[model samples]
Target: MIDLFHCFGAKPAHRVDTSLAAEMLRASGCRHLAVNTHTIDQVTAGDDLPVGYDTATLGSVMALVGEELALSPVLNINHPTSAAEAVKRTRQAAQLTGIRVIKLEVLDPGFKLSVNAEVVEAARELTADGFEVWPLITPDARTFAQCVELGSTMVRVMGSPIGARRGIEPQHLEPMGEMLVDSPVPVMLDGGIGSTADVEQAFALGFQSVLVNSCLFADGTDPVTALAGFRATVDRVASGTPAAH
Candidate 1:
């Protein structure tokens, strides 16, 4: 069955209560979670956090232990400066947290969509270090191939601009499908994924996983309820309960 991972604050935004979020994660049965650079500060501060909490940053994507309630934050590293600096920072985080899955978001200082040689090099370095490098890149077939060529562990794509809260539209899926048809590595659907319909569509197309960010972390939203809904959908689809599809 295809599993899903969640990403929160994939871009710079307000702070979140890591303790509360961790509670929701366990209650909702969410096994994987990611927090971008912006959200990292909240969990890593080590000041006044609830007892029994340990801070560990995985490259922007963390594997949560559901029953134990251990929150391993998956870090979404945004490349705000030179490639070397980005790589260095990631390596340091990995060393400190023992995070294996590193997501590299090649965003320039202006936050514009950027994919270049330096960005690719940073990914290569992370991969060579044995970290599972997942690049959050624009949804382009060529760029997908480029990431795979560099030996990325996973290739994450966003059809709409990141944080746009748009789903995988047909027009975007056609090319995304073509890109994954023969990919040796797994591909993920990022951005614009907020509902069961989106999950079904992603499952049908060949996405190994889908990312949920703003939809789960938005104001006034109940993340536990939302994540439960998504998990139910996964169960239904995996069971071949035709009604769900």
Candidate 2:
């Protein structure tokens, strides 16, 4: 089945009542939640905070979600000074959380250049340590090729810069779609998904999964209804029916 990851408790600003969100997710048949550990600043500053960083409140939420739905802790490696640091942080987080899949956030606003090589190396090391690695990357052929070459389990391509509410840009879809078709590993669309239409478009573009956040926690968005809407849209697309407007 195509997995839909609802990113809850990813940022301090979006932490609004995760218990209610968790309940809603369960009821809506959403089976995955990706929790954000630390912000890009904390990682770049080399802060030694606790496991979940400022998002420690999510610990109870994760437990509340239980075994039916899988939980993935998103470890942001966007600002690691070195590749070794990135691998160390990923390994530590996986071991601490006991989660089999570790989502690595390598792309961020601070960095202007591509860090595909560093991220690929980290994924390689983590795989050797017996952990499934999901490297979050930009939609580029070279980056996708490297991740596939390193045997990544799944690759997450952002629709836009992380945390931006601008959804997927029209210009990005063609290249993103091409890469998705050619990628050996499953490609998940992440970031900037603002509505059910965006979700429909991602699935239409051939992404096997989607990681969403901003839209769910938006000012007036009803989490329960939104989750259900996305689930229904995915189901329809998977069955080869046209998505409902």
Residues 75-126 of candidate 1 have per-residue lDDT tens digits of 5576455667668767655655566777777666656455555567788787
CA lDDT for candidate 2: 0.64
Tens digits of per-residue lDDT for model 2 on 90-120? 6655545555666775543464223666777
In order, candidate lDDTs are 0.63, 0.64
Worst 10 residues of 1 by lDDT: 45-54
What lDDT score goes with residue 20 in model 1? Answer: 50
Task: Give per-model TM-scores.
Answer: 0.77, 0.78
Q: Give the candidate number with the greatest lDDT.
A: 2
Worst 10 residues of 2 by lDDT: 44-53
